[model samples]
Target: MQRYRMALALLGLAWAAGMAHAASEMPVPSALVGAWTLERVDNVYPDGRRVELYGPHPQGLWIIDAQGRYMMQMVRAQRSGFAAGDKSKGTPEEYRAASLDSNAHFGRISADDHTMHTHIEQASFPNWNGKDGNSAYTLKGDELSYVVAKPSSGASEGAHGEVVWRRLP
Candidate 1:
């Protein structure tokens, strides 16, 4: 009788521990629900040298709702102008066209919160115009690290970089 009760108590404790472990492993989508800003960008050059690129402190906001709807908005600092590859300049018509072309280049967090995908459009060189590339992200707490790869067109081959972001207050 005493032995039987001890066995049952151990079984119950084991079951509770299993439940706790499972709960900890379960991915919570709400954990990533907030605004984030680009803190720093670490670029890996082809020569195996890593370079850090600092932007004009671009601020980005990411919102994830319970309905699985997500939206992000990023704006560069006013004092810091756009990069050479930025397609948001020129005449009004040109800007409109560029914005439309680059609209799909935004980033979105996966439903599992394990992956983040970002798209970027490149139209700088005439030969490489209308080219888009994607980057994959791995998140750790409030930090997100991404690896970006350029498309293969012989124009800008093997161009890759990693960017890290932190959740804003």
Candidate 2:
């Protein structure tokens, strides 16, 4: 019966090796490498008010490259309670100021596709600048979620926000 036992052990070893090879050949998902448009943004105010902003207010574009380069652009919506073109027109100085403000909300994904860092150079709300915030991204199936956190100054812990992106065809 020693030969029989040896034959069974060899068969088990062969089966394990075949399973490892199959696992290594598993395919990576293809949904992740493409461009996605921002469909909705829900902002929760500090006073427990939730606002849903939609329509052609502004447009956003996000591109994810297979080589791991990511970029995004978002335009701000026009102010409420005022008709279009009611706000200050674009003078050279006004243009310069708006450009500076636009630069603050942009962000980039790291080369490794693991970290997303956003900088707020100047905030319309008080006391938002001079601080850095980042999110870590995890890929599962076709959805990517980022958990954002900021630094605290002993008063309270930093706030957290989750931004989810769905892969586009």
Candidate 3:
């Protein structure tokens, strides 16, 4: 029994170590060469209604290093302060609020100048774990904008969301 417990513990440690290494190693795509700041994200419906996905002045940043690893984060504007001054001391409501207001993910990417494919290794949103997806993008000067090549479940036919980004120098 003691031997089995020791084996399990070592396996757990090995898995954690593997995850840490994978997080830092990735091949970055050339078209997404720089850091990009989120300008806005909007969901347009077939009925012509436009909805802001993260409130006005939504905050986000995406960075793709030369190695192909990337980290992306987004949050609603003006998130509430955790009253306790300690992140772990926040109330359940505070925790829920924070999760609902933001998202983050990290992974590897492959792209040409027009299309990007992501292999998500980790994500704050659990449902996206181990998922792979792609987007179509366009770059004009300092701006880089992209849209999901396929309609999301919330989108009606012929409707999609657009995420605009500004290239960082």
Candidate 4:
């Protein structure tokens, strides 16, 4: 009786492992699976004025795998460097600049037609860690663009954020 119970437990464990592996293989949209380079980031106000969120020239990369996993990072092209040459020794201004100039996150993502859903497991901003977000997007040829309903950048009261990317070759 003891041997039969042990065999049944081992069989159940093997079945559970197989199910877990299958869950990670969830398919992602083909159009969104690739390496993409950031083209620009902007903030558009309610009045029709648009401002560059990350300076005139920004830099970033976003990579999405076929299995719905992704990582993304974006930064201003002209961010100021720390005067101390050591990150831990930066002053208050330096720390604030560093935090405001970059954004990064990674986790599972999925898309359906016009909206992309993100499950951020971790992010540069602690508030976004373990958060889920949905953003509307447009995919035209090699370019993909999305608009954030509410921006993290503390812009003007009614400003919305936009980010554009170009698919890599």
Q: Which ranges in model 4 have alpha carbons more than 4 Å from their true place?
A: 1-26
Please report the TM-score between candidate 2 and the true structure: 0.40
Question: lDDT per residue, candidate 3, 6-118, as tens digits?
Answer: 99999999999999666444345566777989999877777888777678899999998777778999889988989999999999999988887787899888675576778
Q: For model 2, where is the 10-residue window of minimal lDDT?
A: 102-111
User: What lDDT tens digits, residue by residue, belong to model 4 across residues 1-169?
Assistant: 9999999999999999999665444467899999999999888988888888778999999999988999999999998899999999999999998998999999998877678988899999888899878899999999999998878764557888999999999
**lDDT for every model?**
0.50, 0.48, 0.80, 0.89
For model 4, how big is the CA root-mean-square deviation? 5.6
Candidate 2, superposed: residue stretches over 4 Å from native: 1-32, 39-60, 66-69, 73-108, 111-134, 151-157
Q: By TM-score, who's the top model here? A: 4
| Candidate 1 similarity to native, TM-score | 0.45
What TM-score do all the candidates reach, one by one?
A: 0.45, 0.40, 0.72, 0.81
Residue 147's C-alpha lDDT in candidate 2? 51
Q: How many collisions per candidate?
A: 0, 0, 3, 0
Give lDDT tens digits, candidate 1, residues 90-138.
Answer: 5666564444222112323333445542222333334333433335567
Evaluated at residue 83, the lDDT of candidate 3 is 97
